[model samples]
Target: PDCEKNVKTLVDGFAAEGSPIVLVRHDSGDPESPLHPDRAGNAFKPALDGVEPALVVPKHVHSAFHGEVDLHAWLRREEIGEILVCGIQTNRCCETTARLGGDLGYDVGFVIDATHTFDEPAQNGRDALGADLLAQATATNLHGHFANVTTTAEVLGAIPAAG
Candidate 1:
């Protein structure tokens, strides 16, 4: 619920500070999928409606680094050394991006609260993992290793004020 709001806060804060903002959109190959290019879910949320990003990356894979647009190359060309990652599916796309960003040598900040995920059914009769648990796991997995797991407030506070 708070994911979208937190993302908007981060977007506004970064924009105000003149930071390069990159938005990644997932384009599912299946036409019937909600995230398909022709579907309404392909559009950004209402909170992000008027936000303009420096780049919009259309991705078919979970990792933003492996998207249609070469995110790593763009960052290198722009001389951007650090990145803040936030998006839907905390355990999937968000986590994947953070992990790959770290491997690619970018200073990565995984905004934990700005991401969300759904409960996943376990295999082999194992217990289902709740969304909250999955999100926490993602934070634990990324923090200190792949990225610095942080909150929306922390990220906003780090952004320099608009001069």
Candidate 2:
């Protein structure tokens, strides 16, 4: 819910600037998976209730670039040179997509505060990390290399001033 506020703000600003908002959703393609398109978990969260995206892409993979929805092609077709990514599971899909976009020659802006993730258990019996720490780690990895880790306000401020 907290991250949603930032995401909503960013989306609204982009909409005001006539920037296309591409909503990339996960669909595991397995009926048993909660992320299956037919499952309730696949529905857009309440935070996005009134937001209308320019495009809604359903993907079967973590990286939107490798999804069945052909997000890369769409971006190319639309002449999109940059992407602002914010969503659930910050360390997984959001991070992967940002990295892929950068490798593909697109400038990727990863809104750290606008992305969220669940607490992750320690892999080797160490202390588990909280969501906030995970989010920060993701931002640290993405910054300077894959994407420009940014804030919603910074991105909004970069939009050209309305005439």
Candidate 3:
């Protein structure tokens, strides 16, 4: 519920500081998929309606790094050593990006509250895993390992004020 709000807050805060905001959108190949390029569902959230990102990456895979645009190359070209990650499916795309970012030697901050996911049925026929549980697990797995798991407030506080 608060994910969109927090994401918007983070985006606004960073944008105010002239930070490069990279927006990643999943574009599915299947026309029937909601995430297909031609589908309205592929657009960014309403919260980000007026926000303009430095880069808009169209990705078919989970990790934004493997998108049509060379995310790493662009970051390097712009001399961006650190990145803040926040998006849908906290345990999927967000987690994958954080992990890959860490591997690529970038300082990654995973905005915990700015990302969210849904409950999923267990593969072994056990009870469905709750979204809260999945979120917590993602935090635990990334914190101090793949990325610095943090909140929107913390990220906002870290950004330097506009001169």
Candidate 4:
């Protein structure tokens, strides 16, 4: 989805600023299927080129905090004041992590456009919404509720480096 391409903008911004960037990769090993971290499914779509990741986190569940405890420790050690969160499955991992980040006292910024998610059936695929509707609902639920849901350009512009 767009999360892969959208993150490139963040990488570029951080690169220009001479700051460090951390990459958290998810590998659930599929509750049904194993070997979840395939090359195609490893990183977000449209992966950025020429960006050296400072950290690589491997996670299983939807909550990054649960899989990668070191991320919390690392963020604390590095004095990470704010978290710019965007990733796949808006209702699952991204949403869970954003909530965790807020609970951890980080200034959470949700890049609404930078994240991508698919439609999910509710109650065992019985009642559910489409992807677009789900995305919109997620946005509405997140905006002013958990974090500041914004766009990629707006988030980049808010940074000092983008100036």
Candidate 5:
């Protein structure tokens, strides 16, 4: 998708600007665990296109803020006030992380199309996870519920020098 490519470009642009790119990796090892068993490390999708990760936050829960996400502390250490939150499983980590980011006083932003997920079999993708549903749900809830969800192009255009 264009969004994935654009997001990679954005990630690279940030690197060129010397901005620290924070990556939140979710682990799905134990079904009992939030993102455990089948959900871990699935945070990144093919859209990332092999882009190197700057920081990998191994989160066992839905929220990256949990289990050593240390996002808040990391933000402080980097003197960052705004976060460009992008990753997989939109309805889960993306939503959770955005809310937590807001609570911690960082300006949270979402690259809606850059992230994705598979909805549970409950949604009927022939027993497949309906990521479409999850992504939509996340967009609905996060748009005004916690953070501002925007597209990669719009976000990149919003960057001062990118303009």
Candidate 6:
């Protein structure tokens, strides 16, 4: 989908800016689960090739901050006060991290356009909520409370490229 392309573009933009990009992968730890890092399904996408992350965080939980990895400590050690959170499952991991980051006292910039989600059937099973609709709802929940919801273009435009 466009998520792969969009995430690639954003990662490249950050690389151009000399910003350290952190790649977080979910490892369910269940050998039978395809989500395990040992499984091919959990492998990083080709778009992530050549993009070395400052840190590779393997998380089991939806929130990256809540994982065993000491992300908060690392951020504090680096004195990084703000974070641009973007990735798949707009209403899940992405939203969870944004909320937790804000609670951790970091200014969060949520790139709404750069994130994506899957559709879910309505509670009554009448219809499925489209991806776009889910994204909008995530933005609403994060904006002004957890983080500032923006786009990839806006974020790239805001940060100056590395010399």
Q: Choose 4 or 6, whichever is better by lDDT.
A: 6
Instruction: Give the per-residue Cα lDDT of candidate 1 at 70.
Output: 98
**C-alpha lDDT score of every prediction, in listed order:** 0.92, 0.86, 0.93, 0.76, 0.73, 0.88
TM-score of 4: 0.86
lDDT by residue for model 6 (17-120), tens: 78889998888889999888779989877889999899988899999997778899999998899999878779999999999999999999999877878998
Off by over 4 Å in 3: none
TM-score against native, each model: 0.95, 0.91, 0.96, 0.86, 0.76, 0.91
Please give the lDDT score at residue 115 for candidate 1.
95
* Candidate 1 per-residue lDDT over residues 1-163, each given as its tens digit: 6999999989888888888889999999999999999999998889888888899999999999999999999999999999999989899999999999999999999999999899998775688989999999999999999999999988877776822
lDDT winner among the candidates?
3
Candidate 2, which segments miss by more than 4 Å at Cα? 161-163
RMSD to native, candidate 1: 1.5
TM-score preference between candidates 4 and 6, better one: 6
**Residue range 1-163, candidate 5, lDDT tens digits:** 4556766878877766767777776676666664553654455656555666667777768787785667677768878899877766577777888988877777888888777666477655566646777787788887876788898888878777676
Off by over 4 Å in 1: none
Worst 10 residues of 2 by lDDT: 154-163
| lDDT (Cα, 0-100) at 105 in candidate 6 | 94
- Candidate 5, which ten residues in sequence have the lowest lDDT sum? 34-43
* lDDT of prediction 1: 0.92
What is the overall TM-score of model 1 with all chains considered together?
Answer: 0.95
State each model's C-alpha RMSD to the native: 1.5, 1.9, 1.5, 2.3, 4.2, 1.9
Give lDDT tens digits, candidate 2, residues 1-163: 4688988888777778878888888988899998987899998888788777777888888898887678888999999999988988899999999999999989999988898899888898778989888888998999999999998888888888522
Error of 4 at 26 (Å): 1.2
